[model samples]
Target chain A: MGGPDYAELCQLYARYAAALDAARWDEWPEFFVEDCLYKLIPRENHERGFPLATLMFESKGMLQDRVYGIRETLFHDPYYQRHVIGAPLIHAATAERITCEANYAVLRTKLSELPTVFSLGRYIDEVVVTDGGLKFASKLVVYDNELIANSIIYPI
Target chain B: MDGAEAVFPDEMTWPAGDVGRVPFLAYTNPEFHKAELERFFYRDHWCYVGLEAEIPEPGDFIRTAVGERSVIVVRDDEGAINVVENVCAHRGVQFCRERHGNRLDQGFTCPYHQWKYTLQGDLRGVPFLRGLKRDGQVQGGMPPDFKTSDHGLNKLKVATRGGVIFASFDPDVESLEDFLGPEMLGYFDRLFDGRMLKILGYNRQRIPGNWKLMQENIKDPYHPGLLHTWFVTFGLWRADNKSELKMDAHHRHAAMISTRGQAAAAAPAEVTQVSSFKASMQLNDARFLDIVPEPWWKGPTAVMMTLFPSVILQQQVNSVSTRHIQPRGHGAFDFVWTHFGFEDDDEAMTQRRLRQANLFGPAGFVSADDGEVIELSQMGFEQKPFHRTVAELGGRDAADSDHMITETLIRGMYGYWRKVMGL
Candidate 1:
């Protein structure tokens, strides 16, 4: 509402990054609407019109399942990921919906090792003003790098 | 069992010629790695390069590598597929720099100097053949004896099966059918039935471990239920399932098949005691684990087929992909994963495949666990290069077995490696 308050949107983006960086994955689904689309895709695939994505979730329920599996069922090395998000550029906005893009990077720190840049990408988002507040309806992360080091256990 | 006596000696020697015992030096020795590339990759092996669907139109092409040598697979004006070395004949620079492109018009032109080649890799023109200033003058030009035909890019023997493309440097290698025996051929056909394939995307991962470790991880059927807890906790794979390690005659290739619904009525005590297998763990959205069965595949719900030295064809539930293993060095390698789906798949089927993609890429739920384990195994050899990894799980020989609990496939792969390396 009111031409998508730019400052408010930036604050929302900051909170999203904080949640992921802190490993509070259980609270991740709360940032999205009930029927949302979340995908992590390579820039090459997006340019070539390929449908495959590194991580794809059609609904908030699927996103929650991923969080649950990684926290409980899956076994991965212990590591922490810190996300640094840049200012959002609002492309279009209305009373009901908003479109925005932002540059982001993630650094991974394992045990006593120094932090290293794990991934860098642009988040292309479609947001809507729901009853609860502004929430993401679709988030497409298009990573620029082609080579992934070892495995990406945490979401970037 | 004697950890004290397992010291790596300076002179690598295999006292017993047993498949159960493999020298750790094989994974850490750079000299051995170079020799293996020469004997196996450069000479006799049929390496998987790309898919036919990638270059459907004439002039469409994709560049790949064999060992360290660059190669390009392109379709000519005559609609014939050709595999040629990517090196330019003039200055030896890599001609095709882009990963994939369409050379519809004049063909590929070297950016370094103006050497040109047709889509079939035939030398066509140079910057100034006769002269720089005048057309028919013999100034600053090649000799009259110079022949463009002799300067074409080096070509390889090419073959196709079930839409998959493979190439070999050896001009007289056996047919692709005979190379993949009757058993392995059946599995290949089942996964790549003549149906049109659609490119989903790719996941290129650089692992800090030997390339052989990646191949061994796929071949070893014993680790799935143990190392990847997600497989067991979610009931995707069980030790009680009907599974087997099918190998070619010379033990160069193998296919590991495991079918669902064949889980034993009661898992053995040892299986139940495994810390990873927790029947209580369940998923909130079980659709991610759903299986949309294909009519062509009637045998197993999952299959990991390896073509020796490098490629792996994998089907984990509904997600299908081809992994091209490229060795960077003795301690590093690149796993190029090409994910795909059938062209005729409906919207729901396509979404199912896309959703199930989380099961095996570098960040895959099932695959993420492997990169670390393989790296740790490689690190173990740093201190004891002479120490041998004990592979005596099922037996001392490399043979096929109906049971899933075995390292026979790993032994079988090494059996072929030893012969090729002349170790």
Candidate 2:
């Protein structure tokens, strides 16, 4: 029994960023376990131990619903988002689970404007071993920027 | 020609006296924006500072804004909340950089010069007031008649009700009760019914549009059924829902109250005709819509109250929040959402509230559309300031109505805007 290696973790992150960057939102939830927690919150609230989050999906079902919202429900000016994720720093590792954190910056380019840094944050993750190699049991995105530019159409 | 006077030429006329048609200049002209700041935010109006829950303990302080001016809301040692301008009296430095913190021991000290003020913003200590002695002779000291009391931080007149706090820079401003009026006060009280509020979290975004547009967004109920697909398709908020539009006597404030339509009710032509509505649309996770009616809601499931140029009190089903509109110049404003729930709410209810909050804020399912549209609207306004917009949905007049089809609320706001702005 062994945990996911550094190379495997990087591959997982690269694939995740690729899917989000290409707007293949339908495949987003597949990177997570069935009962997963995905939350995007500000550092202000996180440091203060607040319960609010910009987007909180408790289960994979909720993430799928969000995908549905991005695809069918929400109407906005379509834009492209590129994720620049740093190397993951492993905090702890076990045969069944691993904990890691990484810095990330999301750049958004509207059809009419130049690319701008839309969201600057770090991902605090808890990955678990499953048949699919590695999946996120909990993914918490804590953004450092206090004010957002209009709205965040795509997930960070 | 002077810079200030040149900006105010005589050619900026509103499109109509009835306020049914508004010119783009209202959102484009910088001079008009400055006038708006003076008339609406700076004087004779109680602008929201922050919740009392935010500064519960003595020495707790949070830096907030009244319009574009920075102010600090703090709880003093004697259990009194005070709002003081962040600008220091000496040298006019805008100190107090941290957004929120507990400054119990040292009070507020300006880093530029060690000028200390009490928790109540009273000027208490000034170093070397008699000048430092280098050769046994006093030098570079203030005049003997200089008084510390006169140099205190600019304290605002604060009003607290039901744990919410509002402050006014104008000393002659009317009481908060009178400012809200009787009708608007009822809706305000209904949401803030004297219960201790537990802060859930916050979501802040800078919308690249006029601040008034954010007020108009909540007031204009015509958009929810048309613009927000999640609301129309899920029967959460529709034009056909039993709704009422109300306004203060001055028409500066409004409350858009709507009861959720019956889920089993057949789709009427009003809803079916909407392109955003899809009969097949359903949530993969039903918990997002797991709305449990509370006793405080009374009847209406949603009540969006725009409290004039400062804040919007929102109660959309299970989610509750305060949306503060802090204007920045004419083209942009910072919209901050403070999501909260009552202190006595059970764990299940709290979770429900947080889940339903997904439909709001910067990344909200329904509200994200609003932010985008507002930005686009501003771009259009800047492109052609001579153009005008038509708000003549129900009629050319502004009045309260029983249905959500009317744009009366927006018309009502512009009516008041014209009177106060003298445009």
Candidate 3:
């Protein structure tokens, strides 16, 4: 991958994060593949073979439903989030589709300048170069920090 | 049974039959609640500490507070569980200080002096004690008059039902069966029913309200039709006007019990939240609107029995819970909610329960409203200790009368309060 494709992919990843951390949440669905699978399963349940999840979203529709559910059904103090995504590491690339990974550290400052390292996770992404160049075909975020401050109200 | 309907003494007359005119000081006075903790919680009744599932591995220990003291619940190498004081026996330092962990280094080491003890809290080793001894005449090193037993962690009376473990400072409390009371024990037996619990997660809230009031809020059906109409608007539960709320002889506890009704039961009040909720969500899943997860729970006969003085055994439609409301004082309560599913429940069913979980806690739709209202109520009760609130929801007289969604049970709890405090 050269400058044009590589730079374009990084920008897409950045937008995906921005739409999330910036609370431009509705824009999140566009970042995912229509048939995307997203999940935030706890390690405790994983080890115990429990099927329950802190969050379990099967499709982009379910993920959309999550955002809608949080907005209407949940009551949380208003807060802001900012995501900083690093350059992408292209794992395997083809002309039409590219598999890449990037490290992300999201700094969430709620109501003040005292920003907290909300979550640090590595994003494993599969990108497709379609008419919409370098859109995420699949993004599986493996969050390093357990015990989120509250919950992931929006996609990362 | 209909404690709330009991008449309270007015300026006109004296009331009778263990029903009227109980003082509200128990909610505001730290002194009375403390004595009650000693007499009931510490002396003769067991307190719920933590579930057994919390510490399954050898050397696993978790710190929990029961009433006012910090207690360490540990699982030994032999898989035997013990409830001991969290305080270090030697200098009274906290032994297992962290919330939870595996202390496999030949027992627990106090962070202060590095003194070590077994999971059973026996003196495993005292750091540098033998080396500090002069000429094998261990004079002041081990306190020549000191018996190791004297320094071991003080233990509390403990019992378990299902995976739930309960302990008490009370030396002569009745058995777990008798302690829970027949009505409560029967409901608990049905809820837990000897099933191993798979903890989904824990959510904690430090509500600024009297712990007793927090329990009353849960048992009060009076609020649901008005405050939590969101659930009814979504068609989640139908509160039976025929249903009754009651409490035991000791009014320190409460039960919001609603009997399962046939589909043919007469209509009571029109569901309240129909217009308030976003009509869109009600349009999406009408099943979410009506179908409940727990088969035993028909039309959502959710009963939250606050086991007095503290633990609340909840039987919701999908999520079964045991919330240990550790009262910080007369003013605040630290609530630790443990959500569960039967170990035998299938993956799909478990998922359904977790999804249904959306309706609770602070993030939860149904729970967030109560959470806010309770905190406000706590704030209002102040500056007006003499001014009072009424518990009369379903009219007067006993025998569990009138509307099911009444403050009848709350009144019963206060009656029990007067008995315990001899007020």
Best by DockQ: 2
Q: Candidate 2 at residue B384, lDDT?
A: 69
lDDT per residue for candidate 2 within B1-423, as digits (tens), equals 223332433467665576978888788989899999999999989999889999889999999999999999999998899999999999999989999999889899999889999989999888888777888788787889989999999999999988999999999999999999999999999999999999998999999999999999999988887788788677787677899999999999999999998865557765656765667667778898999999999999999999988999999999999999999999999999999999899999999999999889999999999999999999998876766799899998999999988899999999999999877
TM-score (all chains, Cα) for each model: 0.95, 0.97, 0.75
Maximum-TM-score candidate:
2
lDDT of each: 0.85, 0.90, 0.65
How large is the C-alpha RMSD of every model relative to the true structure? 2.2, 3.1, 6.6
Which residue pairs does candidate 3 place in steric collision?
B3-B411, B3-B412, B4-B411, B4-B412, B42-B169, B42-B170, B43-B170, B44-B173, B251-B416
Taken in order, the candidates have interface RMSDs of 1.5, 0.9, 4.6
lDDT of 1 at B99: 94
- Model 1: what is its DockQ? 0.72
* Native-referenced Cα lDDT, model 2: 0.90
Chain A vs. native, model 1, TM-score:
0.95
Cα deviation of B316 in candidate 2 (Å)? 0.5
DockQ of each: 0.72, 0.84, 0.15
Give the C-alpha miss distance for residue B142 in model 2, angstroms: 0.7
Q: Once all C-alphas are superposed, what RMSD does model 1 give against the true structure? A: 2.2
Candidate 2: where is the Cα deviation over 4 Å? B1-10
Rank order (by TM-score, best first): 2, 1, 3
Better of 1 and 2 by DockQ: 2
